[model samples]
Target: MNEVFDYVVIGAGSAGCVLAGRLSEDGQHQVCVLEAGGTDATPLVQCPAGLAAMSKATHLNWAMQTVPQAGLNGRCGYQPRGKVLGGSSSVNAMIYLRGQPQDYDGWAAQGNPGWAWADVKPWFLKAEHNERGADAWHGQGGPLNVADLQQPNSLSQDFVEAGVQAGFARNTDFNGGSQEGVGLYQVTQKNGERWSAAKAYLTPHWGRRNLQVRTGAQVLRIVLTTTKAGLRATGVEYVRGGVRHTVHARREVLLSAGALLSPQILMLSGIGPAAHLREVGVQPVHDLPGVGHNLHDHLDALLVADAPQLTQSFGWSATGLMHMVQGAWEWHSKRTGRLTTNFAEAGAFLKSSPEVSRPDLQLHFVVAKLIDHGRQTVWGHGFSCHVCVLRPQSRGTVRLRSADPLTLPLIDPNFLAVEDDLQRTVRGVQMARRILAQAALARHGAQELPHSACAQTPGEIAQWVRQTADTIYHPVGTCRMGHGAMDVVDSQLRVHRVLGLRVVDASIFPSIPSGNTNAPTIMVAEKAACMVLSHAEKTSVAAD
Candidate 1:
């Protein structure tokens, strides 16, 4: 190794995958990527039906839990993160959504100058390569493939029609201009397998002369060096295979450790609340108070229903083992049928009212009636519809429990704090009930199993929600971007009062996007890469 490079990216997750691949494409600058997990070597990672095992397997998942929130009825929420090459993208629901245009405009209004909706749309288009081909809204020739659903179930169509019954317009594409609609969701899948960020962007670029990939490397902290000019990010100290090493960065160090761990890494590197660092016996470098604030996530409740189709999950059959095996064979050969389905095949995004402006809720329709997040297969055939309030009003925080790197951090989602947001979610459930009562769904005679006989008042439903809602497992916004005093990064995703460093991940969102955040997180990385290259060019010119 040269002991230094133009850029060094930490964590080869979603953002790091793209950043390292794109930045080193020029071949002039050396780019090294540090990944905490091993390669995407397991078959479970590629199988659409394999997530159930992966979710339970601790091998590649951080699988951390929050430290009891008062807002969530004293419950600690589950947080499953990918500890692998693609990061959570390897294990996520694979639903592709860019979120509402207004989401970006709100960031621009929050004093993040270049983050307006207009500014980010190009990057979104630039990174997508849809299977249906190119259009004004989607790109055809790009690294990631946003393709049609491999498996389409009847319940998905019923869900769409049910949305129309619930007063939502039928939208074919959520990525299109308007997000208010009901339809089947697009996914990041190719030929019945998951096309994760590592699979799409990083895999193609592997072994490039300018790129270096290091797996099983856990970063301890960034090694900062001081010069007469200012503080420079010299390198990162990390552990791989229980051995310690250091890799230098000649230009800048970019952290793509994600929403949760990015701030934890920063705090370990001495760039967080000074008091907390001192309390943990670590000397403070900078007292940036916003390193781990603004934590937000999507809280969803999975409702059970007796649907007609009982063949939803592989965990369902005993004698049908051969059937599941045959399906897998078909998928491996041609990429079709149940084997191709990503389970939660169809979904929709919409508001409870016409004047809401942005979609306030979303639906995730499961083909098979699931029981307890697929932990136990339902004895009888059934289906599920997960309801989540998108862009929740309440904000939370993430903080360190101590200074130890292995120690889990504190995550409080602070859900249902706003009475109005609770009411909105109650209305969301009511809409879901209406959909179940529709002709298309009632034809199947679906019954709500987590049966609540309580009155339909906002108070009643909200109370039930507090008692029942579980995480859809989408967490974000820990490192907020704005011009305010509490903001950690500016619009360019550059940390305030810090040079030669940047954070490109979900943590920098000023507000939570309207829906699933993985695609938007990838888009953020795309825009960040452009900004980093722009800054590098400017820095080079100034130095010359």
Candidate 2:
């Protein structure tokens, strides 16, 4: 006998958590959430500073790599996704941002009604519980807790001063009326601890009888059936503890496995391009050509500098070691101190060129010399800054490596494929250099590392960008929502040709937003929850 659920959500990530939590609120629907990863209860996930270590924790991360990108001079970029209860929200830097209004307005213009900035702003507010209290732009009494860092590193504060000295305004709130300017970032934390989506949504509902969360369940495919109308998703097959199991969904199946895996999961279920499915040995069920197309991400270029005189900056030293131990004690005992800092504490949004209408480049200033996403070790004290294109024109794909569910998918971001992307990246790198050279930062005797110092000219900077640029972990648009021929989902987030199925995550984004994507992803789920419940009510009324 197969266990039945009114709704089966694949992937207990940012969106899945919200869907399950919201759908089961009325106690009328039996919601089951399936997560590929295990628990997110470890201190490594709860402590905000532990993000540096989480990047290299394979068990907590998918740790996938991309196919060689020509735009990156044939370098294979690393992509680390959280394999835990909260998904990437469990292991991210925790910066809370909702991008520019135009980003969502553009989505509405692309034929996705109700996704305009005006429509989505309320959802963002609904999902938020800003500790700074409610305002015209923010909300209170929401689930997710948003607060200022209890203890920000002095170096991070200096970075903000440097940005101001570099000619950019000093705007305090990026999510406020304007996003242009440099300032300290607010994070998704509560009392100096990370407040992931799971903590905000799923954790509180653990005792709910109607909601079931199954971790460590690797879904192989969505079980589809040939119905009287057309193909409909009936259930799903997954493996857990080396045993295969099937679960039935009486109403619908929601795929929220994120931008990369969501598309791969659909394609594995024979829902992608027909030819590609055949090549990969999966029998085609529905020919949705956009299942794995339209992949894009923010390509980031780093500028590292050696600032040995700045003792506040994190690095390898006797004093730094002592500080780390003390900070750990403070965080464990009092839940406050330097250990509460999300290293990329301060950042800014600026135009790469004066002619641009809005900010095209975003900066993340780290209090440590971060290299290779903090996987590689740099021995001395220093600082680093990352500048990424807010909206990239280059597109790519996510194809299957083989039919085996255990096999990872082939991910190609195809970064900088468009010449304009490269030019913008170069301009961003120059701007970052100017900020770092400013008197506020330069006072610490910061010297550019050899990797970035050699690139002085525009030609040299372009080559340097090709050699060094990589993703800042914002990958989206594989199963974009639109009315176009290539769109996989409709405005309501339903799979176009398949009934009783939908994708609710960053994958459905028509295009990438202007800044960190976590906040916008949560907003999408908040709005989707309302839509799902409303649809269920209408269906019940019609049947009655």
Candidate 3:
């Protein structure tokens, strides 16, 4: 391993890939990226339909389960994070959403500068290569490919019609115009295959001599030194193939380890709450109490119904299995067919209460009866609609279980801790039922599952949601960006009270955005690249 580099980025996830690619573009900086997992070269990672199989592949997934929630009848929720080159983007549903503009404005209001909607839109465009071509809202010739799904199931189109019939506006583009309607989602796909962050950014730049990407290199801790200037992060100590190695960063160290692991890494480096550090047998280096605070995630509840036709739904029938076999051949040959479906294809963003300003409830219409994050099986063909609170009032935490760098961190989302969060979720469930009951969907002879359908009263619905709701795969804000006492990083994404270090990932979100987090996380990294480069330029000039 190299002893030193201009920049060392931890975790080659969505953010790290962008940083590695962009920072090394000038050919003047040596950038090294470390990933805990291996390459994303399998068909399960390249195909859009492979999400079902990939989600179950334990080797590629962190498979971290949350501590028993006080909500959900004390049932533990499953937390699946990708441990590969592209990180969660490799295994995600591949939906490309940048969230509402007001989400960024909200961040600016919360003490973060240059993160308002107007300020970050260009960053979004900078990293995008939309298939629809560039306009005022999108870009062309960018690394990330955003395109329409090659083949969306008829059931998904029916979902959009059903949503429109249920009194919602029809939106053809969620990224353009307002985000208050029903539509088919545009995915991060190229032609017919999945286009992950690694594929978009890092893959194209693999030949860059200044860039070094090492897989299966798990970072043990950030190597910090207490110099007279401050506690500076010099490099990171990582274990690769059972042997430990250290690589120093001559410029800065970027922590892109994600929400679940970034805080743990910081705490391990003695940069978190002093009491918690001492409890875990680590001496405190920097008493930054907010390292693991402000953790939150989107909790969603599914309302499912039966769809008897094998062609429209996925189930255990012989005919369904036959269709799957045919679909596989079709996709392999022409990259077209039912295999191109991203499952949660059509959806809506609606307000839970008319009095509320923006859409607070987000829905995902699935062509299958998804239960327990698709871990459990249902007997027959059916469809399901996932309803989640867009702006949850509830908050949670990620704390160290021990000082051991390899141990799993304790994740407590504290979902439904706020009564209003449960109330909003109940309203969301009612909305889902209304849309499913619309004639556009009812024509398929789909019947709502008896258990959830029977809950007519608000109390009954709340109780049902509590027993059933779980994560829709968005967890963020553990290492928030702001100027507050609890904020870990500032608007520039630099860790507070520390020099020569920064965190660029979902972990630094000041607050969770109003939609899917992948695109926004990528945007954050794009902007952070400029910040890091500007810092380096100034340093160079000062030295000259």
Candidate 4:
């Protein structure tokens, strides 16, 4: 006999934590969530400023790198994912944006019901606890905390002023009526600390007897059965403390392991393309061609500049060290100061051309001289402005490098594969240069690093883009949602040809949203929780 629960959620990530917390709220059902990573108790995960340390914390981060990208001049791109509870929400920059409303409407038009902007806004509201209080568009007293930065870096403000100086409007809320404009980002923080999904959803429910959360438990694959109805997932096989164990689900097994790993788990469970499964030595249970096909991520190019002033910018000088000590003391005492920063504090949404339907480019203004994902250290103080394409045209794949479940999956975000992607990226670089070159930022007298600002030709910009462009860490659509043959899941998030299984994470997104994905992922879990509970109620009524 095996331990059986009403629901077993794989990966206690942004979506998984929400599902575990919401589904077990009735107190009658048993819900179990398994996380591959350990607890989120470390200060590096709790403090907002710990994001800087997280960049190098290999143990806490997946730190997956892509194969050399042909579009990037064969440069290997760094992809960092949080492995601890709350998943990437615990380690990300913490900006909370629901993206453009049309992003959801576009999904509905593409054959997904109940996901349109009008239909899904409530879910977003239901999961948020905005500091500004509730409104028709925003909600308060919800699980996830959304707050304005307690103390934004001065350079961040300068970026906004520069954006305005460069002819862009100032937007107060990216999650509000419109996303177009430059402004300070509202982060997923509460009282200067990082408010990851685990903090909002899982922490409060830890005492619930019906809910069990197992950390450091790596799921190998989903257990499935061939019934008269079709393929139905029954349980999951996982490893903990070097011992293999099995847990059965009485009702459902939800996969919420994110975009890169969700599809990898599906393929490991023998549910992907039959031919590819065979190649990986996996027995085919189902032939879903779209399991890992629609892979995409927001590709970005960065512009690093030299800032001589250590008081306004972050650097490695003795004065900078003293400032850090004082900032730490301030945060420890009042939860305020530089320690509250999420690094990419200010950003914007803008269009490259009038013909573009929505903002095709987004910006992240970092108050530090970031290079190579902060892996390469610079000698002095400066700043970086990252310009990423909003909706990339190129697609890639996440494939099994081997049959072993513990083996890392091959990630190929074949960025800039489309010529237009490169062209648009060049436009984004040009836009960033325009904003950085404005009078507000120009006051710092920052000079471009590595690449000369003198290079202004289209070919020069295009070559520079190819030389430096990489991911902003928003990977999605590996298991896309739709009604088409290649679609992995339907509108309700159920696998197309499987029963009692659902992917309740970003992997199911038909297309990536326009901004940061954490908010949208939380919303997806809220909606999925309702669908699961509704189906259970209907089943009980029929059983009676």
lDDT of each: 0.81, 0.93, 0.91, 0.91
Name the best candidate (by TM-score): 2
- If both were scored by lDDT, which would come out higher, candidate 1 or candidate 4? 4
lDDT of 1 by residue, 289-349 (tens): 8889888888886677764344443335553466678887886777676766777877777
| Candidate 2 TM-score, C-alpha based | 0.99
The TM-score values for the models, in the order shown, are 0.95, 0.99, 0.98, 0.98
Superposed Cα RMSD, model 2: 0.8
For model 4, give the 10-residue run with minimal summed lDDT: 307-316
Clashes by residue pair, model 3: none
Write model 4 residue lDDT over 141-260, tens digit each, in one string: 899999999988989999999999999999988887888999999999998899999999998889999999999999999999989999899999999999999999989999999999
Which residue pairs in candidate 4 collide?
Answer: none
Off by over 4 Å in 2: none
Q: TM-score of model 3 relative to the true fold?
A: 0.98
Best by lDDT: 2
Shift in Å, residue 373, candidate 1: 3.6
Candidate 2, residue 127: CA error in Å? Answer: 0.2
Assess candidate 1 and give its TM-score to the true structure.
0.95
RMSD for each model, in Å, please?
2.0, 0.8, 1.1, 1.1
